[model samples]
Target: MALVAVLILTLLSLGIALSGTLTRLLLVVVPYAVFTLFLAGVVYRILKWARAPVPFRIPTTCGQEKSLAWIKTSPLESPPCLWGVIGRMALEVLLFRSLFRNTRLDMGQNRPVYPSAKWLWFFGLTFHWSLLIIVLRHLRFFIEPIGPCITALSSLDGFFEIGVPTLYLSDAAMLAGITFLFLRRLIVPQVRYISLFTDYFSLLLILGVVTTGLIMRHFFPADLLQVKNLALGWVTFSPFVPQGVGTLFTMHLCFVFTLLVFFPMSKLMHAGGVFLSPTRNLANDSRIRRHVNPWNAPVKVHTYEEYEDEFRAQMKTAGIPVEKE
Candidate 1:
């Protein structure tokens, strides 16, 4: 349902743009608005997370701590210091180390056994890395006089030379990864039970974007010069909706705009949130240092002396020992 809705919306957008009435609006104003929203939303979320107080060092530990000298400590797993924390965060951000180490439990002969979930990790890694590459590959469209590095990256991505236009491997990998991820949510009973409309919506939206992009690249083949001109105009702040750009291109842009607007408001904000997560970012140093809650309030208290003084007469009558006496 989510997929159908997004696809319909995208096609509707294409139709609206193709009518030529909203060409300027769709190509110029909408992109500007979406970009502004994306920037503002990302900043707001990051600042919100930054202002949140984490009074304790509560990094999630998965290995041995820095205790005895003879015992080995897993610096990445149970980070005990600032350097260790940096290394851990680096691994998490760059390689998704935690996801790579993910395991699944299965029942066999009435006993549970842990098994490596490498396929999930592979798909996850492929999805993220390929997405990054694709985004970078798009720099050619936005930048005038494309850099050698971008050219090199593009060459590396299309190294397989599979087709007439030289199909990039990242595109296929991205599609495969996204398909697997969506299927996992749908096919797995436990996952399906917990899945929300938003979860499926996000996946479907991305899939729509990828599919439209692939169509434009392989099947329809939009005029690259016109597309680049549109991109360059937007980047330079002198926005102009280029003539002769196809409906598929417009639909692709619509999907991208939708994604940008939806990104910060959805689970996709994990891209930035991961850095702010106390569980992933903090050092596991509770054993080495005492952490006090900075937000703790001061309060008036009744001392033992005050209590003894107040109860002195009652204590005398009851023959109870009193500190005052």
Candidate 2:
């Protein structure tokens, strides 16, 4: 149903673009609406999270902590300072360091056991890096006189010189990575059981967007200047509809806009949430110092000695160690 919805919506967008009835409406009104929703939604979500009290220094620790001068600590896993935290965040966001260490559980006879699940991480990294490259490569479409660095990047990306149109390695990598990710979700029993329709829908939507984009670039090329003008107009707050851009390009742009508009409201917000997460950002320093939650109310704690004192006679009769016995 989600896939069908995506197909229908994409086809509908294509129809609207082809109708030639309200080119200015989609070019101006739609971009403004989508941009506003994207901005407002993201700010609202981030603010909500910022206002929520964490109340504890529960940094997500996965390795040896900083303790006893003689023992070494995994700084990336349990950062004790800002520098370490920065490094940790870098690896986490860019390389998916934690996911790279992910393990899978499987039933062996009557027992359950964990096994390597690094393939998921591999594909995830590939997908993200390729997607980033692709987005960067797209700067050429939005900028006039395209910066030297972007031109260099474009040259490097299509260095293989695969064809007349010049195929990009990032494009192939992105598609392959997407395919691998989609298959992994289905092939892994645990992942498959935990996956929701939203997961499938997101994957399908991205794939559709990528496919349509590739089709536009290769099979049905459009006026690069016109597309760039449209993009620049949107950015400058003076959107204008450009002629010669195919309906397929419009549908692809719509899907990309949809993803951006829906991003903050969805689980995809985890990209930002991960940074704010106390568990992943806090230091494991409980052994060296106290971490008292300011919100915690004072309470009387019962001591072990008090319990022993109360049951001294009983403890002695039962042959248990009693201080008073």
TM-score of each: 0.90, 0.87
**Model 1 Cα displacement at 144 (Å)?**
1.5
Candidate 1: tens digits of C-alpha lDDT, residues 1-325: 7877786877787786678867678888988899999999999999999999888777899899898889998888899998999998998888888888888889978899888888888999999999999999999999979999999999999999999788999999999999999999999898899998789989988998899999988899999999999899999999886887988888888888888999999999999999999998888878788888988798799998999999999989999998767
Worst 10 residues of 1 by lDDT: 14-23
Give the residue spans of candidate 2 off by over 4 A: 109-111, 298-325
lDDT of each: 0.90, 0.83
**Which pairs of residues have clashing backbones in candidate 2?**
59-279, 60-279
Off by over 4 Å in 1: 299-325
* lDDT score for residue 129 of model 2: 90
Please report the TM-score between candidate 1 and the true structure.
0.90
Q: Quick one: RMSD of model 1?
A: 3.3
Best-performing candidate as measured by TM-score: 1
- Local accuracy of candidate 2 as per-residue lDDT tens digits, 1-325: 7678788878778777777765567777888888889889888988888888877778887778788789998988888777878888888998898898898888989999898888888888889898888999898877777999989998999999998699999999899999998887889787889988778778878888899899888989877778888899877777777876887887787788788877877887887888887777766677767888989899998898999988888888899987765
